[model samples]
Target chain A: MRFFINRDRFVHDVQNVTKAVSSRTTIPILTGIKIVADHSGITLTGSDSDISIETFIPKEEEGSEIVRIEEKGSIVLQARFFAEIVKKLPGQDIEIIVQDQFATTIRSGSSVFNLNGLDPEEYPRLPQVKEDLLFRLPQDMLKNLIRQTVFAVSTQETRPVLTGVNLETEEDELNCTATDSHRLAMRKATIERNNESLSFNNVVIPGKSLNELSKILDDSSERVDIVVTENQVLFKMKNILFFSRLLEGKYPVTKGMIPTQSKTAFKLKAKPFLHTLERALLLSREGKNNVINLKTLEGGQIEITSISPEVGKVTEHIDSIDFEGEDMRISFNGKNVIDALKVVDSEEIHITFTGAMSPFVIRPTDHDHYLHLFSPVRTY
Target chain B: MRFFINRDRFVHDVQNVTKAVSSRTTIPILTGIKIVADHSGITLTGSDSDISIETFIPKEEEGSEIVRIEEKGSIVLQARFFAEIVKKLPGQDIEIIVQDQFATTIRSGSSVFNLNGLDPEEYPRLPQVKEDLLFRLPQDMLKNLIRQTVFAVSTQETRPVLTGVNLETEEDELNCTATDSHRLAMRKATIERNNESLSFNNVVIPGKSLNELSKILDDSSERVDIVVTENQVLFKMKNILFFSRLLEGKYPVTKGMIPTQSKTAFKLKAKPFLHTLERALLLSREGKNNVINLKTLEGGQIEITSISPEVGKVTEHIDSIDFEGEDMRISFNGKNVIDALKVVDSEEIHITFTGAMSPFVIRPTDHDHYLHLFSPVRTY
Candidate 1:
């Protein structure tokens, strides 16, 4: 089995697949990347059990030859070293020859590297998901939804399902939610789909896998086809395919956690509120729960204060152009407020509170597409 | 105490001094930066026992007022948090007011921060080194001398003094050497000194401190004054005073490790050889010593090879344009060779070897300012 491929094209595809390469050598063969060459093109696959990434370099691109398959075959080589060698190769084009004995030789300008290759048959095959349940969405919208909610996901392994973002689809609307109990973030968007009223409630995809996928799909205007199955999900774009195994278990009903009514709400500029929260966090670090008290004073003003027995106290007053409600005082983790404020892009934000102890909701003053909620701490 | 200072100028000085701030809280006060405001200006100091950096912000610079001191006093605040706040402050000028109780109020554009401050008298004072034993050198040359040899210093604390670079001055020549037993790097430069035939030998400065000093002295053309004492060394540049404690005990004699005679010598381009060593290092990761073999063939060519039982083998030939002496072979740590090559700025390099088992020398083809010696590993 042998193949001669253009170095630049091969390197590009190798990098894409290398993102999913297993750093842990638990499964010896998984640490290597599988390379298969045939009449059509060369495919590189890297997997770490939870996520698998495959990139294909065609025989020709835009009427230019990219590869020449002398003999159709497949082999697995160490991903780490192979990628490094390909990137550092000194030539514009590279020649790869795989002998019948499974010895792979890679040669470029003035440099040649021979790597011991393993039988590709030893590598696990990628699970095939039927495209019947596929839905297409703009990559930009999907990336935004992931970034907005993924950071709120529980990173701990105690409740494994909480470590994944829950995606629910109803008719033409897509809802994504992530929560770690202390704080929760959700984003909603519209996508074109033929399956009317289809609901994928509690379909949890690991937050880490989503982040990696987002980094690989940097181009915004491109459309990505997502295929969902009972146990695995696939995202297809250009010549790359990304597959991630779905977390097994039911996601908690977060709908009940978000308050349906508010006793008080105030509209404040997002930047000013974020800066106030940051200042409070600085002072809160010396306190027990990193807690800061927020008081809605008369005449559209909010006072943020924190006090440490040994470090003294700090007080900051931020004025709100519009405020209406009974004056209220509440204490909450300053970091939670800062995190929630970061996801709100609007200049003005409306924050609603249902008593001091209940979870409060914060959203853009004019947009219903994103919502952030934080549970206030009892400072008594 | 009260003072109004230019925010940008204050932030710059804080950043420079914060480099010496201790991350560990073993001595709580060491994590705090001491700020003293006088009628002249404000001085900020940060120290972590091993090194101390002090930066002074003058009341005026180039006929423009940078600081307006209302009252003279001093206080120590947490270095990490203070620096962060100063950087994020919203105004061009910051107003600082200190109360009799030591509660400091820092105000900027619509934002006020009150931090608990400590009495500056508790902070350790800088060591006094007599200015008589001082010499001047170009900052760029000093930085160059440090970078060329500091990497070879022994990191292990087994021999405490070996962890520092030894600087010796004789007549107008300044010589520096560092070694980790297996390899050695030495650099020498001509400088003007007060004493015509001064011999300042065995002056060991900590490797870690030199690294920080190198980063702070970014200007190559500026002149820096060096003051040496029995226990401390000071580098004065402009308004900054950098102090480092000297390493106790005698440094090892590295002169015998460098061989003056050689049986084989050859000249090669620095870039090509460096790239070849990098490729060999990539293949050597599977071996215990990360060893790469180099053999001088009959023709003016050198063969580089690395083999691993499980990772196969790689062999490449590098043609030498100029060569002389007996044909020989040697093996050394690929990492050491790559590091040595990085410091060399010349296009052509000269390598001399006494024997396969003896230490070899590498230097620029036309310069005598720097020399790198590496001991060959027994490949057989």
Candidate 2:
């Protein structure tokens, strides 16, 4: 492959693809990034066992010429070294020429580096998904949906299905839910059908993959095409494609776990709630399960306290403007609710408690579509 | 003891002292920070076996009240947790009250944290160094002197004295040097006698301690008083005292290692040289001793090249307007010179070579007192 490409643009594409390159890959070739130069532009592909990422740099975008193709060829370079060298190259443009036996020579300014590359034919082919089940959604909403619910995904592999965020689509509305048995978070977003009927269910994306995708995804008005097949899901951005293997097995039904009735309810400012929970956690984490107790007051005031037998105690009072139902006290993991409350961007959050031992939910005051539910610790 | 101090200032002092606190300390009480509040202000201290750092917050400085003491007492609290609590406290002013049996209650705004504190008497005593041997220097210059030579200290514990930076003073001039046997970095400065008699020659401060002190130290015009004792060195500032134990045993004789007669000498811009050496190291590091070959051309156009048998090769040319002596090629550890180049703050550096296999000296064009010396690799 012989091509001269803008260093900055090529570097951006290289970084995006390298997210899928892991050192723990069982296949040796997967440790490298597959690069191919064609008439249109250059494509870089990287893959681990579960996820594959491919980014393309067009010959020219807008009025600027990003890449000029001198010849068309393919090669796979060690991803780590290639990324570092590309980033540190000394010129505005980088030229790559793959010679016989995959000895790739990269030149920038007065500096030149020759790296040992492998045959691109050794790289595994990217899985193909049917285009029929593709749905379009705004990139911002998709990112928000992932950020809101993915944190509660079970990190333990004991229940492998819970380690992924379950995606179920009915008509045009898509629901994403993740639960670790003790705590659950759910978010819902609408997808544009665009007349090409797209509806599916039982697609579980590993929470780790979702987190990495959201980290690189730009929060812009650009739309992202999500293609879901029987075994793999693909997220296609402008020049980048992120492919993740669909988790096998059925996701547990979390609909029955969310509490519908409330023994006590309060509408509290989300920021203060987050801070109070964080401070209480500082002490409770020093104790055991990060458990903090909250007692309702006569006039909408709630006192939060965390006591550690070894390392002292912490107490904080949060003032709630609105309160309803019976006054009660409950203990729950401070970190669980703290994580949930931080993702809620509402001015106020409505917290509903079923009882001292049952599940309670903290939801945006204005919206009922998104909420965080957690079971309380039996402190009594 | 009860005191209400400005949270920001208190946290700042705590951070500086905590650098001396390490989790690897054997003494249980050494893991905690000793805090004493008096009528003057509060003093915070943290210590490991090698280094101790104590910073004092005065009641008032330059018409600004930093601490208001309500009662007088002393106690030691776990450094890690106390630092975290003080940083995340919710008020502008933090009130710390030590009750009977060292029960420390820290109240900020409406939030309160009760921590178990041990009696300050249990904390290990700080070393008392005599004030007779004290020299003053600009804090900025001291920091610069440390930065210039500390990186060359041998990280391997094989040579105990080489792991520390040797500080030697003769009359008024102070010289600092560190070498890993392969390369040496030396810096010299004139110390102000200020009517106090101070002269020392056999003190070697641990490189780790010097690095930590330099990191927290401010590069200002203010003077830092350096007090040297038989086995310890104490640096005293207005409200801060940094104490470090000196490494025992005789330092290696590195004076004869610097070559006086030169076969080639050239003056080159430090920046381009640094970048060239950095790039060469990237390729050479894949090989043995991070060796990079530098060929001094007739017109002083230096050609830098690094070749690895397994991974490819790299060649970079550095342009030098000034050239002297015959053409010769020498290979040395690129990382050693790269580090030396980074610490040099000069626009132009003069490099003197004494033949192909001998050690070379690189010094700033304007200064003759400080230089970096490295022995070349004898490649067959």
Candidate 3:
């Protein structure tokens, strides 16, 4: 393979693909990135069994030449070394030439690096999914959807299915939910369905895959086409295709866990409340669960406090708007609440409590599209 | 004790002192910062036995009030927690009050923290060094001297003395040197001696202490009075006093190791050569010592290459200025050369090599105040 490409564009594409490459993969060849140069452009692929990312750079972009192809061929190079070299290579243009025994020489300016390349034929092929688009959404909206629910996914592997976000469709709205049993985050987005009658409810995408995809997704409002098959899902962006294997288990039903009634409810400014909880957490963080206590005060006031037996205590008070129903006290893991509040985009957050020991709900006061549920800790 | 202090200035003072406090210290009280409030000012001190940092905030500075002291007393609080709380506390002024049994209350805005404090009497006292100033140098120059030599200090504990930088005084020049046996970095600065005949040849300061001190030093050219005692060194800055325990041992003689005669010599732009070596190191870093080869080519040119038998090779070429010796080939650790080049203030750096098997010297082409020496690797 012999081709010369723009250094900046090549570096960008290589970084995107490298997100899927694992340096400690059991399959040694999977540690390399597969590169193919053809008449149209060059393609780079990286996979680690669970996730595969492929990015393509065309020969010409916007009437400007990006890649000049001298020969059509393929080779796999160690992803870590290749990525580092590509980032640090000098000059505006980089030339790569493959010789006998799959040895490749990369040249730019006054620097040349010869790397031992693996035979592309030995690399595993990416799963082929039907290009039937399941749904479409703006890149920024998809990123928001991922950010709102991904952090709630269980990091523990005890329940492997909970380690992924569950995506289900009902009519024109798609509901994404993630929970580790202690807390649940749910987001609803209106998506354009390719087929009105087509729907899938059991798709569970690994939280890690979504996190990586979020990092690579652009902030632009460009449309992203998503396709899901029996065991895999594909997110197709401009010239990048991200494939992730579905978690092989049924996701637990979480709809019944969200409280529908409240014994007490109050509205508070989200940012101020977040800050108060953060300060309280400074003392509670020494404890394993970071537990903090919240109590309703007279005249629409609330007090938050945390204590580490040996360290000391922190107490903060914040004003609540439209507090109603009953005065109550509750304890919870402050970190989980902090996470939910960080992703909340509303100026005012509405919180409701069924009882001191029951699950609570926090949702943006201005919208009904999203809500977070937390199981309160029983404190003596 | 009770006081109301400006938040920003208090936070800065607390952060400076906390640098000397370690949470894992065997002496429990050493993990806390001792705070003493007098009629004139409030002083904060932290010590890990080897190093101590104390900062003072006067009741009034210029014409503005920085601290309003209600009573004079002292207490010790956990440094990590106190620093963190002081940083995040809201409000322009923070109010601190001490109650019975050393319990303390800190209030800012609507936030209040009750912390358990230790008796200030239990905190170790700083060494009482003679107040006679040993010498004076600009703070910025001292920072530069530390940066130039500290990186070369031996990290291995087998030779405890090598873990510190040796500072020797001769006339008005203070020579600082550090070596890890493989490479040596030396820097010299002219200082105003407080005593004409006072000199110390065996003064060694721990590299770790220098690193911490460097972080606290400002970039201003303001003169800093340095006092050296039998077992301690004190650096008196504007409102901060940094004390470090001198390493107890004789430093190895390194002056004679710098080769004065050379078989080959050349001058190269420091930045460009640094970049070239960085690129070369990218390939050689996988090897134990990151060894890279340099060979003089015809027409005042040099080629740098590195190979990892299993991986491939990288070759870069650069033109040398005033190349004045026979063609020669040598191999050295690229990382060491890169470190030395990073600290060179001059545009051009002169390098001299006696033979492939002997040590070489690298110094700024403009001045003789600083030089770096490295032992070449033996390669077949």
Candidate 4:
């Protein structure tokens, strides 16, 4: 490949693709980015068996030339060091040439870097996916969905299917759910579907892959097309393509985890509730089990307390906006409660408890569709 | 100790003194900060054997009350946890009381933290300095002096004396030097001396102590009193008494290592030279030796090159602003060169080379009181 591309544009593209390129890839060629240039544009591809990313830089966009092509060829350069060199090279435009035996020369200003390029044929090809089942959603909405639910996915690989976020469409709405057996987070929204009768279900994408994809994606109003296949899925937007493998086996039935009715429900400001738990957790974290207790006082006040014989105790009072039903005390993992509360954007969050022994649920006062459930720790 | 102090004022003092409190301290009480309240003011002290920091807060300052003493007593509370609690407490003023049997209660807003405080008599007392030799200098100047010389101190504890910066006074001039045998940095400044005949020349303050002190001190024109004794140095500033233990052995003589004359001297813009070395080092760092070669071309052009058999090679060209004396080639550890250039504040830095085999020196074109020297690597 012989071309001169804009340094900034090239650096931006390389960073996006490098997220899928892992240094610990069992396939050696997967560690390098596959670079192929034709008369139209250049395509850069990176894969680590779990996820694959391919981005295209056209020769010209909106009558402004981004890359000027001289010869059509292909080569693979070491992704990490080459990316660093190109990013730090001091110039506006960078020239790249592939000579015989796969030797690549990158020149910018008075600096020239010669990097070893692996054979392009050695890199694996990205899996092909059909457009049989496709859906389009705003980039910002998809990123929000990933952020709200991915943190709840199980990091332990005891059950491999629980490590992925379950994304599926039913009727006209799309729902995403993730659970680590202790807590569950679910978010749902309506999306545009290519086929009206398409009812895709049980397509679990690795939470780690969704996190990386979210990080590389830009938060804009632009719509991105997602194509689902039997074993692989592809996300297409602008000139970029992101592919991720689907987890094997069926996801657990998490729809039964969230309760429809509550025994006791109370509304508390999100900020005040988060801070009280944070101070209480400081003492709980010092103890063996990260547990804190919440008690409702005679007045419309809640007492948050954590005790550790070795390192003192702490108690914080949070005035509840409203409280009803039976007054009871509950113990919970303070970290799990804080994590659930942090994502609620509303000023007030409504928490519901079922008989003090069953799992409790927290939902933003203004949001009706999203649900967060936590299993309380039983204190003897 | 019972007092109500301004939250911001107390947090600042705790942070400053906690630098000397090490979590790995052998003395159990040293892991805590000692708080003593008197009729005049309150004092907070922390120590870890090598250094001790004591900061006092008066009852009133500049028409603003900083602390109000309710009783006179002393207690030692865990430094790290107490600092965190005081910093994050939600209140304008914090109330602290040391109850009977050394139980301490801290109250702020609606949050209360009960901590286990140790007996103050168990805490080690800071060393008393006689102040036979004392000098005064602006805080900014002292911080600058430490920054210039501390980076060159030996991190390896093989030779304990090399780990400290050699500081001495002669003829009203204070000079500080630090070297790791491979490179040496020296800075000198004239300060106001209380005893005109005082010439203490054998004090070697640990580089680690100077670094922490520099971090705590603000950049201002206020003068700081430096008290020098037989085995301790006290940096006395506004309401702060910082004490550091002196090294036990004699320091190596580094004054004779800097050459007075050179065979070739050249001046180049600091920014341009630094960028060239940075790009060259990217390749050098990948190589096993981390050595970069610089050669002066026939027509005032300088070229930097580094070669690795497996990773290819790179060459950078820097158009010299000025060159004189001789055409030569020199190889050096690129990291050392970068470290020396980073501290140069001037637009242009002058580099002097004795020969291809000998050491070289670098100094800013506008400053003559500071000098940096680096030994060349012998490449076969």
- Highest-scoring model, lDDT: 3
| C-alpha TM-scores of all predictions | 0.96, 0.97, 0.99, 0.97
Across B48-80, the per-residue lDDT of candidate 2 in tens digits comes to 978999998989988999999999989999888
Candidate rank order under DockQ:
3, 4, 2, 1
**Top of the candidates by DockQ:** 3
| Per-residue lDDT of candidate 1, residues A189-297 (tens digit) | 8877756645577789999899999888774778898888889999999999999999999999988888988888888999988887777676678665789898987
- Runs in model 4 lying further than 4 Å from the true structure: none
Residue B46, model 1: Cα distance from true site in angstroms: 1.6
Better of 1 and 4 by TM-score: 4
Task: For candidate 2, please provide the TM-score of chain A on its own.
Answer: 0.98
lDDT for every model?
A: 0.88, 0.89, 0.94, 0.89
Q: What is the lDDT of candidate 4?
A: 0.89
Best by TM-score: 3
The recovered share of true contacts, given per candidate in order, is 0.54, 0.67, 0.79, 0.69
TM-score of the B chain in model 4? 0.97
Say which prediction, candidate 3 or candidate 4, comes out ahead on lDDT.
3
lDDT of 1 by residue, B1-380 (tens): 89999999999999999999978858888898999999889999999988999999989999999999999999998898888888877789999989977899999876688888888888988887788767788999888989999999998999989999998887778889998888899999887776664568899999999999999987568889888788888999999999999999988888888898889888889998898888888878678678999999978898988877788777788888668789999999989889899989899999999999999999998889999999999977
DockQ, per-model, please?
0.58, 0.69, 0.82, 0.75
lDDT of 3 by residue, A1-380 (tens): 89999999999999999999999899999999999999999999999989999999999999999999999999999999999999988789999999999999999998999999999999999999997657999999999999999999999999999999999999899999999999999999999988887688989999999999999987899999999899999999999999999999999999989988889999999998998888899899987769999999999899999998888999988899999999999999999999999999999999999999999999999999899999999877
DockQ value for model 1: 0.58
Residues A299-322, model 2: lDDT tens digits: 898999999787788888778877
Can you tell me which runs of candidate 2 are displaced by over 4 Å?
none
Judged by DockQ cut-offs, is candidate 3 incorrect, acceptable, medium or high?
high
* Ten-residue stretch with the least lDDT total in model 2 chain A: A193-202
